[model samples]
Target: METLRNEIQQLKAARTVNVKKDVQALRATHAGMEAKVLKGEKDLNTLRNEVAQSAEKAEKALETGALVLSVLSTPGGQKRKMNEIS
Candidate 1:
């Protein structure tokens, strides 16, 4: 009975060591995943800023185009003046 108890204790100790290693590996994996998530969030914010800037530039360009069109469409504007001079 004593020998059996010693064998059981040895098995239990081995299992404990394996569990500890597994826990350490899991913690490492969790840390790596967290880092990746943070980096992804940073990248997303950068892209969003770039998109906002691009949209603002596009809006400005559209406003400039509308102003040009309105000026050209008005009576006695540049187009009518050019036609009269021609």
Candidate 2:
């Protein structure tokens, strides 16, 4: 019975040590994932800002193109543009 008790105690101690190691590994993994998530959020925000700026620039370009087209549609304006080009 004494031998059996000693064997049980040793097994329990080994199991406890394994559990502690597993906990540490899990915590480290969790921290790494959290950092990745933060970086991903920052990247997403940067992309969104870039897209907005690009859209604004495209809108301005379209407005300018429309104005040029309207100006060219007039007869006097066409002559003026041709003269300027020459």
User: lDDT for every model?
Assistant: 0.95, 0.98
lDDT of the structure predicted as candidate 2: 0.98
Give candidate 2 regions above 4 Å deviation: none
Query: For candidate 1, lDDT tens digit of each residue in 1-86?
Result: 99999999999999999999999999999999999999999999999999999999999999999997887889868867588779
* C-alpha positional error of residue 50 in candidate 1 after TM-score superposition, expressed in Å: 0.6
lDDT of 1: 0.95
Write candidate 2's Cα lDDT for 1-86 as tens digits: 99999999999999999999999999999999999999999999999999999999999999999999999998799998989999
Best candidate (score: lDDT):
2
